[model samples]
Target: FFFVACETHRARAMQDRYVLVLVGVIIITFLTFHQEICKAPFMPHLTDPEPPPLPPMLMQSKRQLLPDMDAEAPPATDVPSPTDPAPQLPPDPPPTGALLPLGPSLLLYKPTTAPMWDPTFVPRWQHLVSIPIMRSRHSMRLLDLCITSILYMTPYPKFDVLIMLDPPSRALIRKSFLEGRLEALNAQYLMVPDPIYVDDFYTGKYWWVDWPMLTQYKKVLYIDNDVLINADLNDMFDAYDMEGGGHIYAAQEGEFWRMWKSTPMFGLTWYKKTDYDRMNAKGIQSFNAGILMFVPDQIFVTNILEMRKWMLKWMEREIPHFTDQSFVNHWFNTRLLSKSILHKIQLFPEHRSYPGKILLHWCASFGTPASVKYDKMSSYLTTFIEPRLPKRYASRDAMVAGLLRPQMVIAEVGCFTGNFSQVLLETQPKELHLIDWFKGQGSGSDADGGTVVKLPGDQALQMLQDRFASSPQVNIHRNNSLHALAALQDRSLDAVYLDGDRGYDWLMQDMLLASAKVKPGGWIMGHDFYTYDRVTNKKAEKSLNPDVEKTVNAFLQASGLKIYAVGLDKQTSFAIRLMHPVFWFK
Candidate 1:
């Protein structure tokens, strides 16, 4: 029994050990799993992928809005390769200016302290620009002053012209520029330190320093009062080698460079050879200070003022040589700056005329204050200058011109004051029959065409008589257009231009008369097709002539007439008549 009891106790102890071993294994497994779960967040799985991109804040557009947009455009124009001038913005335009419409037609600007010329004066440059323009109200006959300035503006009408002034001068400028032409011209006036009295000249060219203001322009030109422009300065501006050291554009002073050295200064003292040679050398050219072209900048301005100061000191201590020109010759010729000349384009000899002469410098050309100086200047007005000026026109110029030919019989039905007859005259028609009543609803009507003078019916007849007096091609009948047109033989005229009496009845009557007179396939063109008032910037509620449009449409509808072209330009309608088979045969 004792042996059996000992064996049972040993078995129980072995069973307890087995239970302990199993419990220890379970605790170790739980601890290891918990540690692995904690570590899983810090180390991500390798198989995971990135999230998607966010939507746009707003809808995107594919439409092109830039010059460089990936679509084709006209190959870009090269920026003007003018003198290596720094880029420039045009001057701020002056405030609302006053127009003097009375005698001379002057426009006055609100003046500012802008400098007259550019800070950099490039000597003998070709491109043109300016400082300012002012009108003079003085003794020199206004016509002389006006024509002289007009010469400067003729070539550069595309740019602003600075006329230095007579109030009456604007009249000539206006006639030269504004009359029957459209040009992008702005007249600028420069105010200088005044009391410049040489032969009572008001332009005061001697006070050129006061011209350029603000120094903001890329290129500036000083066209002498005497110089005539042959072409625009764009070519000249481009001609310069802009890869430059600072320079000003001016003409070589020619004989004056050599002449002034020997001539007495102000007729007082002879310029010694050594003193003259200091500022003059064959290698170093003396440029005319009278006309200059330059870019405006701080350095250019500093040089100009410094040279002027020195010249003034020289002039005050001794008799001045060659007036203000002495300052320029000394400034550049001292090896102080760089300048160049294309020769044929710049200064020409006084006694010799070259075929390639683009600019004429008359500083001493007329020889010691000639009497007919202005008379010679005025002659250019009729010669090369006016012929080259551009003519601007309303739309449909070619269309209007193409309809007629030389020696074709035509009539102008509403030939009020023979305004449009001038254009038709260019075709040199065989016979131009003009029919008009020449009477209007008193004055202030389109009948007088807003001219200062109002013509009565009799006066209108007389005016046409005098205008066509030189040419036997014109025939005039001052009567009721209906009466006159009714009396005419059918199919007598090639065409009729109706610019007469407004209102439905008048327009229809004129059209009917034109229909009777004009041949089949002949055209009828009239003014005021669509109502437009420039000041209103909208279609007119009522046309200048009511039913001008309605009558035209009704005529076309009734007659079965095909309109070749229907156009509106300068507020005038151009329509061509097509032949109907019945009318042509009948």
Candidate 2:
């Protein structure tokens, strides 16, 4: 037994000696290769010397780079170590995207002059998701689909969209669709500086356009134009905010070799063994730049100047096949390592089922030629997306034009100064009756049980008469809405529009009377119907006549009639096709 114990102790000593020898070999090998490893691209000098002074052009630039920040201080060259505590940030500003107080330590890069693209692009939100549009026939087509999808798919609390337009495209889009479609969609625009070319080729320089917007917005979600929105991006936006705003969030590019060139994994190029090893050690992985979410705060704002220097460096070095995507992956490599997985929006080709994906990115890596992409996007929109989107009319006049048919009898109860009467007549209604007390709206009398006091309609009546006097189909009536609706035979008129007094009981009576007069298959439409937040179903605070919605809803319950359609306009319009027999309880 004692002999066996001695043998065991000797074996343990041998095992310890073996470990010591192995450690010595590793240390010697590392010392011999230290210089070569340090020379690798990924072994970035942690203590890099301060960059040279700003170039003449950058110095003389119109935008004063770092507002209220330390002029002597250099931009952050490295990400805060994971063990380091988070830099204390000021309390969150209101969600309205109001500007934070400019403290001496807070570096902000705001434009001194107005935005070159569009002066009207006043950002009122904390987060803005921007899409860049270049001048071309194909691009214009893409813009239509992109904007349409965003406006349609996004619910009530929609994300603010900034359409970054090059100068040439701005003129063409403004002339063609901006006035009618884009404007109605409430999409904003910014005229970006002209196309920037690197080595006589456009290398996606437009991506930088969003960098400046961070000054105005707390966060910016940069989306490529070719990227089609399949579902609401609200979840993605919320996820970004929840993670805190300092990091860049993007999906990993499936193939690492596409972004980095190193030994073993990526075939040998300029990148050395140590470069790849260091990147792996730091947890850095390349990500697709198609969709990126980043905060525009002091950290990023201060680094704007450093980014410019890096651009120059990459250009002069003549890096092999360098592009904006490659630059972005390296520039934000630190944050890339810990990029939130929640930001991995499903990519295309890999996933064809559109039901679950937030965005369907037709990435350039797919090698789809521009012409082919055009056809595919158009076909996809027409087949799957467009059909699902709700039908939207730009104006009340447009809605009326689509609904009314030629030779149909129509009456507008509050046709003040014949604004809508003109619209009704344009439809070539068989007989258009214009009714108004035209004294504008009257005040409700509390003493008379909320009865609206009718006023004289002399001037307005005369003006309406002069405007529609030449039209043979027009008939003007100067009377209260109740009397005007009552005089008509029951179930006789094709359609009647109630736009008079918005008082609760008065509107209820007007709706009841109009319902009885319209034919079973005809319409009873009204103006000033309140708009509601689509998500919350709460009446919008800005709704002028809140009582109109109350009255319309009350009438629907009592009469068993449902609201057929609601018009998207400042003063909301609604229609109710009289589909069933009229039944009034009392």
Candidate 1, 1-586: lDDT as tens digits: 3543454466477776665555556667878988867643221111124212212311223221112223332121211112223223223334532111111111112223332433443333223354322333221232233333343333223234454543334444454422111122233444342221121121234334455442545565665545544444444455555322346667665543556545432111333344346534645455666467666566766766555444333332333345555545545444336354644354432333335545554445322433344455456444654443222223333445755666678787767567667778888889888887767532222321244346676777777788888878888887777788778887777777776666787787777667767765466777666655446654567665556778887777776543444333435455645343112211
Residue lDDT tens for model 2, 1-586: 4544555566577876665555667667878799666643321111124222323434332324324332232222222223344433333334432222122221112222334544445665677777776655466667766765664455322356777765667877866643333653346776654332222112333434444555676667788777777776655576555343346778766445453544222221233344446657766666776687766666664454344445433333233333455555555653333363544365553324567667777776423445566677777766776566333454466667656677778988877677667778888889988887766543322111223444456666777778977898888877888888788877678788888788998888887788777765567887777664545544478666789888888887876556655666656677775645555643
Which lDDT value does model 1 have at 504? 82
**In terms of TM-score, how similar is model 1 to the real structure?**
0.39
> Distance (Å) between predicted and true CA of 454, model 2?
18
Q: Give Cα distance to truth, residue 320, candidate 2, Å.
A: 1.6
TM-score of each: 0.39, 0.48
Give me candidate 2's TM-score against the actual structure: 0.48
Q: What does the lDDT read for residue 283 in candidate 1?
A: 50
**Candidate number achieving the greatest TM-score relative to the actual structure:** 2
